[model samples]
Target: MMQQLFTNAKVFTGTGEDDFVSAFRIRDGVFDWVGDAADIDGQDAVDLGGRTVLPGLIDSHTHPALMAGTAAAAECFPPAVTSVDELVDVMRAHAATVTAEDAWILGRGFDDTKFPERRMPTAADLDRVSTDRPVLVWRCDAHSAVCNSKALEVAGITAATPDPVGARFERHSDGSPNGVLTEIAAVGDVAAFIPAPSRDEQIDALIALGDELASRGIVAVCDLLSSRLADPLTTFRAAAERGLRLRVALYPGWDPEQPLADLDDDDREGRIRIAGVKVVLDGAYSNRTAWVHEPYPDSCDHGLRLVADEDVRAAADWARRNGVQLAVHAMGDQALDRVVELFADEEPWLTGIPSVRIEHATIVSDEYVRRLRDARMSFGIATHTVFFFAEYDGYEKALRAEQVPDAYPIARLYAGVEALALSSDRPATAWSGADDVMLSVEAAVRRRTYNGIDFGPAAAITAAQALMLYTGRARMLSPLENVGEITAGFDASFAVLERDVFTVPAEEISEVRVAETWIRGERVFAR
Candidate 1:
């Protein structure tokens, strides 16, 4: 690689110091130096013409392949399926294009609450689409999956097929399955036919999604991979070996394709460290499956548990012993408690390691927040602050009337000892770049949604603090120390900005583009 120098640009290292520098040079992909142009005059130079520059924004969490994996087809009714009639119309349209050999007709993004009286679709709805072919649609949560009569039969799910622990098989009072599957294990029958793509294709699709992040100024991602998504590390490892412009830290999931439980996080050759093992404790809040401590005001139960206590402890221990950390996805208070209790256990090897990540710290409690700090738990919050936008996309009244908050609790965690850090949980939720940065810290401080609800204002933190969570404290969510900051000795990873966030209006932060982004002194993203 050739040396490169950038000159005449204003810079913000995201450190407390808002130092504007004159030049930067990179040799062999590391920051050789940064300062007066005269210091490196003999080195090759490219003037930036006084543009803004900052370290590349690092995405603490996301699922790259699965975000772009849904096969594109007809109009997806999604949050629009207001009635059985509407779903029927959309299904019929999707079925019209393919032959029986194409096998299943898939429907994604249906929000059950959007329907009149908030009812979910059943196997009967599939009759309107196609009787000979299988049809399966996913709820917006991606936790519960709905199948038609054909799909149900293919799974051999007669009334006799028993539902397993941690999985829900919604059935009729008459004892027949209603064609809904919840938790990853419940959907196994359908996933068998998902048709595996070659590793290269997986890499291409994942890389394509990364480009979307790059356009938004995200230069690196904590790529969360699952059994359904398979061994993305191999593909990403290959890309890094070839010197791709992006950086990724791979985390494994529990699924068929990802039998990584036996493997270690050692990755000197992959160019990507094994971020950790990802575990799920419950389902999405949208589907009402999150294992909450209190019942949703109108509901009778605490919802679901994606994994049992024993399983979580086992996984966390494995992560603790190995070099990798544990990144648990626990939204409900009960789930969070289980994680904290297990994490706080006095295990010799577990001490001194960074707090294991609790992805989507949605719907937390005051007790949970304190416990998290006492136990030293860390989190990668889905701070797109999107929940308040569009009135949480029209589910507000139904959700608020119940008054039991869903999604992770930013305020409590922020007010508690832990505070907050940022993560996009992408494709899992519709993602936004600036909104993520703003929401992580701003939402924590404001606690009011864009829609004007003081959801939990008491938990909000100041703007300056939020920036630290995303930039300075965020790297700790990984292996710790050398990531997400802009100190001189810390790798020159920073984002150049039109305005220093401390001085910019919080409302306008989301709209500001990165003037330039650098990693290890190399220009990874420049606008």
Candidate 2:
């Protein structure tokens, strides 16, 4: 491969200030050399016009395939529909466009807390849209869904049906299914009835998602669950074969029935790899089912636990024995505590595995932080502060006055954990613009919600520190090698920005545009 030099750029090496490089040489898709312009010999050089350059951003935890699937779904989120009537109107319009063959009307990104009615839409509300066809609109969090009567009937859920082990179908006082499904089990039961997307459709969606991520300067992501594809590995392979742009480290969604075996096959190469198995130990905090230590304020119910402790232990043991990483989705304090204890106890058995990760450690107490730090376990934390920016109102309603201050304490986690990473839980939090790394970074730095509320201001960090979480620290947690830094041995992937993120006001970080995104010494996106 010919050597290409990038010069006249302000480069943040992602190390400390002393490692800053003004020029770098790329050969064979890896950084060949990096140094000040005076020391570097220019050859086949491309002047960057003095633009700012950083390592291509990585979303340590996101669902690209899943978010792409919603491309065709109707938007029922705020600013689109602030009232129940408006929501029904949007769905009604979407329902009218559906053909007889595609009978179900699907929608996503609805938040009842922002609704003027201050309640979840019921089957009766949706029946007004269509009584003949099934209608399913998922909450912004994706942890819950409100289905129409036809959808409930199609899913075979009725008052006579017992609630799933760890999920619930919210009902009226008369004991009839009220069309609100909470948690994955309940939502999955109803969602299972929806026709699965074709393989071609899945590939198309993934390709589009790749382009979208590339446009946003994202060169790689650790996709937590590729979603309910017929075969996630095959689907990703098909996308990669078609020249999907972004690098992906996939962790197939956890299934209790499946054995913990390594699925990293021949196709596991530079762009795609089965990194680990992702399991959700508890539901999200937005839905008030995050398995917290204390009950949610104004309610006697302490959140729900989706997976049993024994099952988590079994999965952890299996992953350890098989030499694969295990990533658990534990959001609540109680859930996080249980995971810490489990890892601490299993420390003796762990050997060759890279790292055991805890996703969305949202509510961490000082004690929990100390326990994780003191255990001396090989662990990683993948968290998102964007939730605080998008869902502060909902969090305020769900948590107590004291609990609100500790929510999404990114700085605290950064101080306590060694392998702390940041991510954008896109589509989960429906802000004006979702899945943007800058938005997440800004939220972490500003510690302010969209409504201008100061949410745990003390937990805020500097822009550079926030950027490190996405670049340097994030790489330590994932299976991706030779990436996430502008060093000589790292992959030749980086993003040129319109403005210096380090000099911009924290609130203006999201406004900083990406002038170009390059991967493997090749330009993938430019604007």
Candidate 3:
């Protein structure tokens, strides 16, 4: 059961340009053959001198155990702290190596709209980095957080507590408490008083973030939240008993004390499975709090709806009565018009489930893309055009210039969705190198933003439709069968590339690179 082949590469069989293959064959892990290498006759080949292969990229939304607890936090972002006095001197040099004098320094991406003090960093600016230890930071869209008066007095969050139903806090004018916590029920009530990493440090941060997402050629994901770990199915069965070869699916986050019949005796084969249920529903248009139908142009308000329409119709009636797939996290346009009117006549993909997705459908419109294409809904759109090149200047300062031509439109969702998927909601969009996938396929084929600014260039798209939203339309929203696509019976899983990101130069498609990655057929990663 072990044959190989590969030869003079090029491959890319996400079918286009006459099914581009230069040779292929794997055997043990699938994909058994695919054309020309002078009609193959050799055995165990492996030449690849031309390099290019493809399809072993699939992110479709991520959060590898919340970016592996941000490798012990403290990063504050943007050319490293663009103000508030370099974010209180990098949180007072990460609280002088935290030898626990009242622990909890944390910290994440930052970006108060590219700071320079454009605001947001209160709690009296993290009490100049230590009101006797307990800082926090977060906002590179982990939907906001600031903390520090010893973390709102150890999360008792005063100023007479209150303010919980769907999050708030940022007070201080006469009303007090200004530690700036905003969405996710006020950043999960100050991250439930911080401190949670054991279970062998969450399986050593999920095998070091699954070998840094298999060295960036990301073999598979869809984690969504995986119950922010504390036994996400025993931390993915101890990350596949420690070999952790990527391929995860997990969705877990609806919890009525872990219901859905406690994942009914789960243990879905090696690389992790529990694929269903994660619900946010609103918040994050670079902190203007995306629940938009219009307001935020410097504010009158029209954001923040952090779930509730009878709790997204009771999490779509428990994912259509426990068949699974729910997803949700809608990004604006009034939370994707109330999740396209609660799955406009639910289909739950004809009962095997995986389809009602919509996470970060960041501002879709044209009458909700014609009400999600006239509700023939089997919905799926896990989007994240690397937040259009990392937050298109905070969506041109909180949208409304005609909602900046429908924010992350991706060529009007590949001319109207049929299961789109692409992702990197990484450390909620700032674990640097803009969560690569060729920098979200060069911001979905150059709709540009890291300062060159051309945001919705008529919603540009086409580096083969942005690498089929991260390969073969991101395995049609993940129950991960034949794997993204290198063709012949699929799943030999690949990546190779060191150029030919579709004949280059769409601003050098994030400089291409990723020289080797394979998965089901082995070679985990190479450089």
Candidate 4:
């Protein structure tokens, strides 16, 4: 790339100190000079017209591979379809578009908690969409799904079928399958039967999604669980070969039943590389399946701890041998406690990066943070604000009154954890556009849910802190290198905003738009 100078703008360098700069010069896809415009010595520069610039954002934990694979599914997320009736209408409308009578009618992002009925959509409700063709709609968390009667039959699930270990097929009063599948095992049972899109189709979808991500000011992401597709690394690399620009670090899921493929040079080095393996330890909080220290209110259940300690150790061992990070999906306090205990005496990585990362660390306590820090192993956390922002109703019911204060305590985590990233577990979250960086920044600053439920400002963070979490702090958790800052010698990637996020009222942060997104000295997206 040729040398380029961008001037006349307020640049948030994400350096955490004296970060703002007025001008920067890029050469060969890396920043070479960053200082005041007057220091440019009369060099020709493209004036930004006083816009606000930020280092390219990084989403440390997301499922873009899942998003790409399910791009064709009908979107049933809320503020669009907030009722069972509305959900049915969406599936019905989508069904109309499928010319083949036998084609499956699929939908994603339905939150039963946000509905007026405040109940899960039943098989009968989805039957209204298509009694003949199979219909399956996933809950917003992606941990559960409710299918129509046809889908149930197609999956061969029945009253006699035993629930898989660590998963459940919710039943009716008569012991017949109610079409509700919980957790990965149950959801996968029906999902496996759905005809998967071809690899080429998935690559195309991925490239399209990459463009969409760039438009939102995100330049890199960790596909926390990339094995949702047939060949995640290859598929992502294929997309990259066809103009996909996002820097992706893929963590293919760890399954004992189906061992991950051995890594090669291609998998180990690239813009899209296999960073690690992920092992899910428990279910989500939204469905009250997260393994918690205490039972959920009005219930004797302490939720389910899906994986065995031995299995987690095995995953850690694998990661250790491979010299890659091991990401544990620990949503509840009990699960988080298990993580701290399991890795307390474990070996640390020779690499400077954290050896283990706790994903969705939903209910972190002061002691937990202390232990994680004191432990021999290096620890990182990739948590989300969108979870509470979109699924507050589910959390409202799942958490005790005392637990609310500590739930997703942003300020505490920022002050405590050395490696912390506020990410968007998109498509998994209840809200549409969950990956929008501005929305998450507003959530971290305001500490308010989508319905305006106040989680208290005591745990809130400043706008700069929020951006750092998404930028500089977030990059620490991912395998992507030379990103998340506008400092000299770093990748010349950043986003130009329409207004200064620091100057905006905290409540109005989400309204801040990305006017342009540049990557490697090239303007890839312009709004």
User: Which tens-of-lDDT digit does each residue in 1-527 have in candidate 2?
Assistant: 66788898899887753346799989988898998877665466788888899898888888776765555678776557777899899998998788858558998888787777888899999999999889999888888889999999999998889899899999999888999999888988998888776778888988988888887788889888764565666788789899786778877776777754554455345577777777789988877889888889889888989998788877776666655678899988888888887776456333432358999888887777788767756777899888878877678877787876677788788888867888887666656456778888889888888789899899999888888887887877787776679988788999999999888987799899888998888888999
lDDT by residue (1-527, candidate 3, tens digit) is 88688788777776542357788888897787887777775565878888778878788787777756555788777656667778788888988887855468888887777775688888887788778877887887787778878778888888888898777887887777888888777778888878876677777878877777777787888888877776677776776787777778888777543455534535444457777788887788887778877698756898778666776677667766655678888788878877777777665544332458888887776777777777856777888777757666677788778767777787888778767877888777743755678878887788777768777788887777777777777777767667778887877888888788888888988888788788878887888
Error of 4 at 389 (Å): 1.3
Number of the top lDDT candidate: 4
User: How well does candidate 3 match the true structure in TM-score terms?
Assistant: 0.35
Local distance difference test scores for all models: 0.60, 0.81, 0.76, 0.89
As for candidate 3, its clashing pairs are none
Q: 1-527, model 4: which lDDT tens digit per residue?
A: 58989999999998882479999999998999999988876778899999999999898889988987777789999879899999999999999997765568999999999899999998999999989989999999998999999999999999999999899999998999988899889989998888888888898999888889999899999998898887898889989999998899999888888776676666778798999999999999998999998899999999888899888888888788777889999999999999988887877974667999999999987888889888998999999888898899899999999998889998999999978999999889998899999999999999999989898568899899999998888877767888899989989999999888999998899999999999888899999
User: What TM-score would each prediction reach against the true structure?
Assistant: 0.81, 0.95, 0.35, 0.98
* Model 2 TM-score, all chains together: 0.95
Clashing pairs in 2: none
Prediction RMSDs, each to the true structure = 4.5, 2.0, 20.9, 1.1
Q: Ten-residue segment with the worst summed lDDT in candidate 2? A: 345-354
Q: After superposition, how far is residue 74 of candidate 4 from its true place, in Å?
A: 0.6
